[model samples]
Target: MGGFKATLINEIEKLYKKKKIIVAAALALIFIIVGQLATIALRNGFGVRTVGSMEFPILVLSVVANTIIPLFAALITIDSFSGEFSQNTMKISLTRPVTRFKFFTAKLTAIILFVFLNLMFVMVFSVLAGLIFNSNTLTAYGIIRIFISYIVTIFPMIILVMMIIFFSNLINSGIGVFFLSIIVFLGFKVLGILFSDYSGIFFTSMLDWYNLWIMSVFPFIKILREFLLLCSYGIILFTGGFYLFDKKNF
Candidate 1:
């Protein structure tokens, strides 16, 4: 346990040094500023409060979860897996007193931490932006809903990371893994659009799983069903990715 903690710390430090987190943070800030500005423009020019305080954050979350968060998840996963192998850095890490499983979990745990922090950062900034710009009194209940909504998003994001990690392990090149991830992700989006009825079955389609939680009446059955689906995907991808990472020559 102690060794795993140390390795996790090392993985996090490497991610911190890589600066992708900085880029993701900056992009999120930019998106919030732009979103608020657009909202202000609409209200001033066309006389509209289309996005209220709670609505603003929710809107930001949709974009962040669907686009920004997943994009960086792929990048970070590729960098941590494929980047390490291509750069011959994984060998150095493996030289330490650590088992392959420990190394894999530590690295993945670090990525999960990155996603969680990034999500929270977006939630905080978007909430503040909404409060500052939109004059909507989010009741305590509404605030609770927003918090729950943001927190629930982390589950799907983790599953997405696991999927990408699986691909990264299969493909040796960082660039190959990145392009393949994008192609596969975009393909999934297109398929979802073309096959609306079957879209619900895809893991990518569950990015907005938070909506089930934030509903007026809790859809317990639907939430549980989707939660179980996500859990299954997470478990399978994580096990498969771990197996590949463990057996790799690196």
Candidate 2:
């Protein structure tokens, strides 16, 4: 436990030193501000009805998942292994008493924590942006639902982080990992669309987890199915990455 804590702290400090967290927060805020501005322009300039405060965060989240969140996920996880390998930090860290599994777990935990923090920041900023721009009344139930949606989103986000981490371990270049992860992340969505008939079998379709909240009539079974699909993929990818890391020659 102590070793894991130390490793987690070290990973977080590295992120802080690199200003990755700061950059994530900045980018999230910028994305929210721009989205709100666009919403306002459409409402006032083009006479469109903007989404209500209750719905605004969901709308922003949909856009973020497609754009900002993927980029942020790639940026954070791209370095999980490739950066360590490139800088020879992995060798030094392995020389410690920590096992490769623990090191990998710590890195994965740090990136998940970072991504969760980034998502929370986005949620908060979206609410603030809505309050400033939208005239819809905010109800406690609405706020609770939004928060729940954010919590549900963590599952898909973890799947994405794991995919990037897997690729990072497979590839030795940080830039290569970054671009490839982004490409695969976005590519999955396109493939999901192209094969909409098999979206149920495709884990990438789970990226639209937000729809679980927006369903006019809640489909509990479908939601559970999608959640399970994501969890299965996450487990498989993470296990594969760990196996590769454990066996790889540094």
Candidate 3:
């Protein structure tokens, strides 16, 4: 147990050591800044009050959670699983005393941690942009809702990470896994739009599980159902990815 603890920490440390994560954050910040500027232009120039101050965070989250974060999650997963293999870091890490499951778990947790930190990074900036530029920073309730929205958003994104990890294990090359994920993601998106009635079954549709996606008043039952669905996907993907990881020749 203690060994696993150390491994998890070390794995997360390795993830943070990457320069790509830093660059990703910078890009996200730029997106948020641009969003704020656009929103300001619409309000002041066109008198089009489309978005308010309190709603900025939720708006930013909806855009990024589905696009930027998922894209980065795929990139991180590809780097973590495939890049390590190509670089032969996986072989060196496995040579340690840690078990396969422990190493996989640590890597998985670290990727999830990266997702969360990315959310926090975006959340903070979005909130500041809102409060500074947009009018009417509302009550504590609004803040709580923003916090919950961002927190709950972590689930679907984690499932996205797992899905990419499964791909990472099956494909030998990092670039192959990445391109395959993009193709599949686009395919799922198109399928969901075409088969709108059956959209719930599509992984891309599940990204809309964030509370404020469309609902003015979210139901507890609906939330629970989607939460369970995401959990099921996460379990299946993790198992399949781990199976491949365990059987890989290195």
- The number of the candidate with the highest TM-score is 1
Q: What would the per-residue lDDT of candidate 1 be over residues 40-70, giving only the tens digit for each residue?
A: 9998999985778888888999999999989
Candidate 2 error regions (>4 Å): 214-216
TM-score of 2: 0.93
Worst 10 residues of 3 by lDDT: 207-216
Q: Residue-pair clashes per candidate, as listed?
A: 0, 0, 0
Write out the backbone clash pairs for model 3.
Answer: none
Which is the better candidate, 1 or 2, if ranked by TM-score? 1
Instruction: Extract clashing residue pairs from model 2.
Output: none
Please list all clashing residue pairs in model 1, or write none if there are none: none
Error of 2 at 82 (Å): 0.2
Question: Candidate 2: deviation at residue 127, Å?
Answer: 0.4
**On residues 87-126, what C-alpha lDDT tens digit does candidate 3 reach at each position?**
9989988887889999899899999999999999999899
